[model samples]
Every structure is written in C-alpha cells, then in structure tokens.
Target: MKKITWLLLLVLLTATIHLPAQRKADRKTLENLQAHITYLASDKLEGRRTGSPGEELAAGYIAGQMKQAGLAPKGDNGYLQTFTVWEGRETGEASQLTINDASFAAGEQFVPLPFSAEKPAKGDVLPAVKEPDNIWLIDVQDMELNPHAPATDKYLEKAKEAAENHASGVIFFNGKEDIGAVRQWLREKPAPLSIPAVWVNRDVSRKLDGDNASGFRISMQVAFQQGKRTGTNVIGYIDNGAPNTIILGAHYDHLGYGEDHNSLAKGEKAIHNGADDNASGTAALLELGRMLKNGRFKNNNFILAAFSGEELGLFGSKYFTAHAPVDLERVNFMINMDMVGRLDAAKGLQVGGIGTSPSWTPLLRESAEDMQMHFDSSGVGPSDHTSFYRQQIPVLFLFTGTHADYHKPTDDADKINYDGELSVIKLVYRLIEKANKQDKLMFLPTKETQVSSARFTVTLGIMPDYTYSKGGVRVDGISDGKPAQKAGLAAGDVIMQLGKQPVSNLETYMQALAAFKKGDKTTVTVQRGTQQQTFNIQF
Candidate 1:
C-alpha cells in the first residue's frame, strides 16, 4: 500500500514539473518574437521598399527566420515569388511638344500618366483652333477645379464626339492656377481618343497670349518606352497536414524614389525608412511567424506572405490573389497586420474586418477575455483583406490606429509601444489557435461600408489608411470601386469635409459619411492642393 501511494505521488509531481516548463517555453517564444520585431522595425532596414536592396535584405532575413523556425519555403525555389513591373517616368522615351513655336520638354513640361496604356506619342505637331472649328479646350481655372471632371465617361463621350468631328488638339488653360495639380491630372491615363492634348501653366498661357503664338504651327515628337523591371513577393509556410490554411500577410513595400512624403529628404533621398508605414507590420509578421513555428500549433497549415508594391495601389496583394500558389478555396481566413507596433495602451487597439467573418468576434472576444487585454472592434473598413473578402475568405485586420508620426520621418522604432505590441501578439497567437480548431468561420458582411455604431460616423469610400501620419486617419490608397472613388476621390486627395460638416481628420470623416445612405446623394469637399472643391456624389 505504501509503494502504491509513492507511485501516485511521483506521477503528480512529474505532471506539475512539466506544466511549468511548457508555460516557460511559451513565454520565451513570445519574447524571442518581440526581439525579432525590434530589429526589423529598426531604422537600419531603411523601410524595406519592394525591389530595393533594403527590401531584399529584409526578405532574406525573414527567410532565414522561417528556416530557423522549421517552416519550409513554399515559394518558387526556396523564397521568392518573382514578377515584373514598369520602371522609370510614365513616358517611355524623350517627349517634346511645340506650341506656337514654343517647345516643352518631357518630364519638365509634361509626362504620360501612370494609367495610360497607349503606345508612346510620336508625330508632327498640328495647329491649334478654337471650338466650333476643329479644336477643343479644357479650361483649368485653378487648383480648386476638379480635373477629373473631364475624365468622367460623360466628358469622355463629349471629347470623343468632338474628336470624330476633326478636332486638332485639346489645349488645357491653367487660368491663373499652379501647374502642379493640372500636371497630376494630365499624368493619369488618358481616355481613348483621336484628339491630341496639351496643357499650359499660367505663365506659359500668358506667354502664348502675349506672343500671339496660339495659332502658330507646332511641330514636336513624344517618344515613350516601357521598361520591364522585375519584382518579387516573399512567401513561407508551415504545414500541419490540413487542407485549410491561415494566412498572415502584410505589404513589404513603400513608395520608391522621392515621390511620396515618406521619402527621405533631398540628400538623404536614397532610402525612405518606412518604419511605421509598413516595416512595423512586416516586422510583426516575421515575429508572429517565428512564434507560431516554435509553438508547434497543429491546428492548420499557415501561410506567411510578404507582398510587394502595396504603395503602388495594393498591387502585390492583387497579384497574389490573382495568381495564388495555393488553392484559394482552401484559404480559411487571413489576419493582416499593417501598423501594430504603435499601439496606445491608454486608448487600446482598434481592429477592423471583424464582421467579415462570424467566427472572428467570438474568437477574439474569448481570447481577449482569457488574456484580459483591451481592444475595440469594427465590422469592416479597408485593407488588403478586401482582396480576400471578394474571394469569400473571412479576414481580420489589426491596427494600432493612426498618429502624427505615421508616414513622416519621425515614425521610428522609438515611437513603438513594445509592451503594448507584446500584448497584441499574445492575443493574436491565441486567436489563431482558436481559429484553427474551429470547424469553419462564418461570413458576415457590413450592411454599410461605414459602421454607424462607432463613436463617430464618417464616410470616405472605405479607402485603406496608408499614410504613416500620427493622428487622424492617413489614407494610403482609395478603393477602386468604392463610393469614394465613384465620387471622383483619388488616392492622394485628403478629405477635409463630408457633406456640410467639417472633417479635420479620419474620425470626423467617418462620422459624416456614415450619416448618409447607400443611395444618398451628397456633396463632398476634398483638399486636392491649396484649394478645396465640392462634388456631388450619389452613394
């Protein structure tokens, strides 16, 4: 009897010892994950723009981490999912335009828009004439005028009709306005038309009128060539023998060159350290990938995808979904991390896309309940998940909200809330584990794109918040087919007003946009440049 008691005691003690060691291992795994995040989000990587050396270095580092975690490379020949992209200015070759004997150089005076799909323009210049004759004119009064006004189908129909009637050239007059906005407008893909088009700045317009060069024969040639530059998407996976997979993705690219505000200042223009713009999210994915691999969760196969060209309008994600390595039908869900390192503990974290999947709310709720963490949830908004949502995959997007240091040079590692981020990762780990164990997730769609139950309501066509700005919502890109785009909103156009209400930031904009209905027609005011203009859009 004494020997039997001793055996039972030994078994209990052994079990007790193993339990604490398992807990210790979990904690250690989380710590190592955080350490990885600190390094990736560091300024050393220089923002990891896709196709750049910094981005390559970052990708190599992630592949190494995956290897170390025992996750196999599911990408082409080990780590890269290579593809091609267009490089250089929008115009392919040297382009020149002569107006009334005055010549304008390509890039300096004008260049092709990024969206144009036509061959480069190269031919002899033609004479200019007034309307009712053989010429059509688009008068750009000032920065306040909406250049998209003429790009609409209605305007294109009119322009096409005029072209068929034998119009010579469409001359755009600045009418005392700065040429920057006009230049941006003209740079967009031109609608298919036979008539040639040209734009003149206020100063140039003055020269044309003063010199009486309007009717002078203009002869010029515009040559263009589209270069084929290669790009890549880094992908890694951990298999658990399940047909369904959970994907954690983030764009690993930022605006290259000195174009966007995030670009480094003149002399320092070589690298735009997108620490918060995306290195934060990319770093978070790296850390999470490592944690999941080490923890050895057996719920489902996991896919870690670091996309390229997000700054170029979610191009990477779009490409990945269109040409997926794995079956899209087997992707159970996606949890996307964009800017998770800048959490404000006091305000907690804001999560979107909760309504996209019915299982998300309950799973997140239970995980938070057990972990005792604070977080807020929204049904839907904008992010890469929109890509998968269109494919019928449920998604959840994690964000730390926006701040003043968002896209600026100030969004460095020091500003990151490491402790808050640690909590978020823990919550994510738990959520992933729970999701893997569930039979399947339920699909839920937001009745309205904008959730009206939030503290404030504003409507801005569910554009993804991309600017790394500190406070107010900084939109990186607008949705292609959302209400905002239908209203003529572009990627860089900042929302200053919604309907009659003034929206100083994203919160206010959301509140205002939510007040309207799907079919509601409202006037929206946006700041395109130095001026604000209103447009009537039917929602």
Candidate 2:
C-alpha cells in the first residue's frame, strides 16, 4: 500500500506534464497556420491566382519560408518550379477594324473573338442584307446577347449561319442599349470558325450601321497574340540519402477576380481569397515541412511541394510529375492536402485515396482516431493528388469539406478553424510517422472516382489536362478499363472530337459528353502527336 501511493503520484505527474506539452505544441501549430493563412489569403496577395503576379509573390514567400525551415532548393530554379500557362489571348497592337475609311481601336471599339480568322478581310457590309462575298453586319440589339447574363452560344450559331450564307466575314454590333463589356477572348478553348468574327462596341455599332446608312466596303486586319504567364510551384526537400522519397503537396492557387469564370459569386468580379479552399492546406504543408525537415523519419526523404493551377485543373502537379528531378520509380507515395482548414466537429474531415494502397486502411484507421473521418478508396480526385495517382503513385488527399464560401471572394482567412486544422495536421504527421516505420509501400491501382470535374451522365474515362489551353481536351491519363482505354486512346492524346460535336476545351468536351448516353456509340477523334486517329467508342 505504501509503494502504490508513490507510483500513482508519479503516473499522475507524468500525465499532467504531457498534457501541457501537447497543448503548447498545438498552440504553436495553430499560430503558425494563422500566420501563413493571414498573409496568403490577404488582399495583398490578390487571391494567389495562378500565373499572376500575386502567385509569384506567394511563391517567393513560400520559398523563403522553406529556406527558413532549412530545406535545400530542389526545384529546376532553386525553390521555384516554373511552368508556362496560357493566359488566353491579347489583342495585337497593330490589329484594327476598319469599316471603309472609319477606323476603330483594336481591343476597345472592335474586338476579334478567339476563333476569329487572323487574315485581312475586305468585303462589302450591309446590315440588312445577307449576300455571298459580303461581310455581313448583324444588329445584336434585339438578340439575347446580354453581356451580364453572358450567352456566347448565339455567337457560334450566328457564325455558323453566316458561314453557310457564304459571308466573307461576320461583324456583330450592339444597338441602343449598352451590352456591358465585350471580352475579346473566351477563357476556355473555342473552336475556330471558318470566317472572321468581330464584336464592335455599342459606340462603334452606331457609326457603322446608322438607321440611314446604306452598305459600305469594309477592310479589317485581325491579329491576336496568345497570352502566357509562368506558373510557379514551390518545392522544398529533406534529403536523408534514403532509397525512396515521400512527396507531400498542396495547391496554393485561387481564382483571381473570378476571371476564369469558375466562381460562384453572383455578379461583379471580386478577389477570391481562398483561405479555406487551400491556404489552410498550404499552411499545414509549411508547418509539416518545418516539423519533418529534421530527418527524424530515417526511412524516406521528404519532398514538400506547393503547387499552382490546381484550381485550373492540376497544371503544376502534372508538370512537376512529368519533369521530376528525381527518378519516378523511386517515389514512395504522395500525400496531398487540398482544403483542410474548415474542419468542423459536426462535419468532420474527409480522407481519400485509402484504396490506392492496402497499407492505407489500417494506418488511416490508426491515425484518424481523434476526429470523424470519411475515407475513400480511390486515388483520383479533383485536386493535385490525382496527378500523382495518374502516374501510378500512391496518393492521399485530405479535405475538411467545402463550405458556402467555396470558390467565392468570401473565403477569407478569418473563417479558418485553426484548432481543427491543427488537429488535421497532427493526424497527417501521425500517418507519416506510421508510414516511416515501414518500407516503401507497394502501389495498387484503384477504381476511378465517379465524381468528375464534368458532372455529366457519361464519362470518357479520361483525365483532362485542364491547363492545356491550346485546343481540345488533352488526355492526361486514361482510366483503367474505361471507354477511352478500351478504345485504344492513350494518355497525351488530344480529344479533338467526340461524336459529331467538336471538342475544343474542357467546356466543349463536357458539353459533348453530356449529349451522349451511356449506351451510345460514337467515333472518338484524337490528335496523337503528328497523326490524327479515330476510334469507335461505346459509352
């Protein structure tokens, strides 16, 4: 009895000591997360939009943070992995629209559409007449061309109609009421039209087609230059001279002013400060980099990567995996954190890619005891992890579930659940800790997630390279046993056409997919390098 009292006291003392230490560690993690998210989601970063100056600033800051964490630069350019992204089209300085002798500004008054022909066009223009060998001027006054409630479907219809009517060129002019702003380029891939299509502003419209004016001979030079921006990925590594490396990643890019039109905001472009959307995950990634860089694991080297253009469809990750500095065969596995900030006790955290490896189920169960977790087996997702999984590397994506402010300007740093995020980060560290004890886990292919970026009834069983802005839906990876794979279409093949519909970009591809049912049979056309191939697909 005398010995038992002292033993109980010692046990109590040890428990008390550890409780405070745990709390202190948690406090530190929360503070660090807040600090990172506050700056990243601040207005100064301008939403950390991919390919913008804001992105560059965020990348530099992250790289600086990595350097502070004692991580050696492992990227192509120090800590920055740069990839080129197509930023739509910009009107050339020399491009102009001239109606007879009246000339107008290239981008201001008359803007050529993305598919507009780049050749000089000279023809007679009459607003009321549709004749062969004439540049037809169509009055969009009564048309459903409300720039606010943007409907560009009519533009293609008009272009097709004008082409069938044998018009040399097509000029669209607005009537009495202003039609908002005329954006020259559509963000997504647009099919090239046979004839030139130009939209003249309301001011230019009245000058060319006044109520009293007859027909006039028009000569116009249409030239558009492709816009490009360097997309950056921040990479830091802990080289322990291990046989394999473990990759931890998160995407740091958010929509800037909703310019790409992926925002849920009703009207007027606002800076989409994606704090919960990804600032949370990125902050967690930075903290992990700091915690794990000490080489305590002793099993595998660590690669901490913050990717950009994930919101634009995993652009940075695809490029990074394609041009990895290390051997792809030696990559152990990848862990991706997308939106792990908004963790709610009631809502819980989402843990995906459990099925990618047999090791995940037991280990995730061991690590996920602190909170409610929804586990998914498939490695493919809507985030950067899919890029790794597509390369046949094991992957996991941690998410805190989406909120009302998702993809909106309202997703600010003030809304992040700091304590909850800390818990999530701890859980991830625990998972990695457990992983470090074992040898490099074997990779296993899992079933593809039905939750596609394109929410259509049918699937082509292909992952689209969202950043491929050139033309068509570029196939990044073909799903196993899917229509694309079964049809002999492989990765890097550009889906130029699906059935009778022409697939230009993701939007067109989705639209074309939506038109078909599961049992429908169609001819799939793909651009494979220099040669074009067509295959029969039943989907």
Q: Using lDDT as the measure, which candidate wins?
A: 2
TM-score of each: 0.63, 0.87
Cα lDDT over the full model 2: 0.84
Runs in model 2 lying further than 4 Å from the true structure: 1-11, 87-90, 98-109, 121-135, 142-169, 175-195, 202-219, 452-455, 480-482, 485-488, 528-533
lDDT per residue (tens digit) for residues 379-414 in model 2: 887999998888889899899898899999999998
Model 1 stretches astray by more than 4 angstroms: 1-46, 50-53, 83-89, 94-105, 108-183, 186-219, 224-231, 256-272, 369-380, 451-539
**How far off is residue 125 in model 2, in Å?**
6.9
RMSD per model, one decimal: 10.0, 3.8
Indicate the worst ten consecutive residues by lDDT in candidate 1.
114-123
Error of 2 at 533 (Å): 4.1
Error of 2 at 167 (Å): 5.9
Backbone clashes in candidate 2 total: 2
Q: Put down candidate 1 lDDT per residue, 62-171, tens digits, no spaces.
A: 77877887778877768677766543234435556665556776655654332332332332322234444444545444224344333333334544555667655445
